[model samples]
Target: MCSCQQHSTATSVATLAPNGAISFRVEDMTCGHCAGTIKQAIEGRIPGALVTADPASKLVNVQGSADFAAIKSAVVAAGYTPSAEPIG
Candidate 1:
């Protein structure tokens, strides 16, 4: 007999938390390099931006004066799939 099971990927919609903080779910972030690249990409585009990425959870939190579109674009530019909706 064979048992079959399918793994489910968590679905997260990133929205503004507080004080201009946002979280994004990046699917391709699997290592520190990826995280660092993402951080740099975002900070480079948005000055005074703080980015924290968790490879284990595949989530990146950005806080400061940054536009959500740029943030998502930065993740894409850094080569990762990001899932989020900007809080306008």
Candidate 2:
């Protein structure tokens, strides 16, 4: 099982690109269903947005016109906590 319980809160942990692509880490999301829900939530809110969520890596990337705040909210709305991957 993915032990991503270390981070249970949503924090400002995303990178917004010039093209509006976002890449962030969601610590509490640890399964295909969790990823699917997040993907659906984001896509539903932002039409034409491409969202890729990987449970194994705990990373979620969004390619479309979505701000950092919006993506974070979507993850939270899906019942997961998003955060930045801890740096070494």
lDDT of each: 0.73, 0.71
Q: Write the per-residue lDDT of candidate 1 for residues 1-88, one digit (tens) a residue.
A: 0012222334457766666688777766777777788888899988888999887787888988557888888777766667767554
Q: On residues 5-83, what C-alpha lDDT tens digit does candidate 2 reach at each position?
A: 4435545456554555677888667778778888998888887789999979878888975466676677677777777
User: Ten consecutive residues with minimal summed lDDT in candidate 2?
Assistant: 1-10
TM-score of 2: 0.72
Q: Show where candidate 2 strays beyond 4 Å.
A: 1-12, 16-20, 84-88
Weakest ten-residue segment in model 1 by summed lDDT:
1-10
User: What is the clash count of model 2?
Assistant: 0
Model 1 Cα shift for residue 84 (angstroms)? 3.6
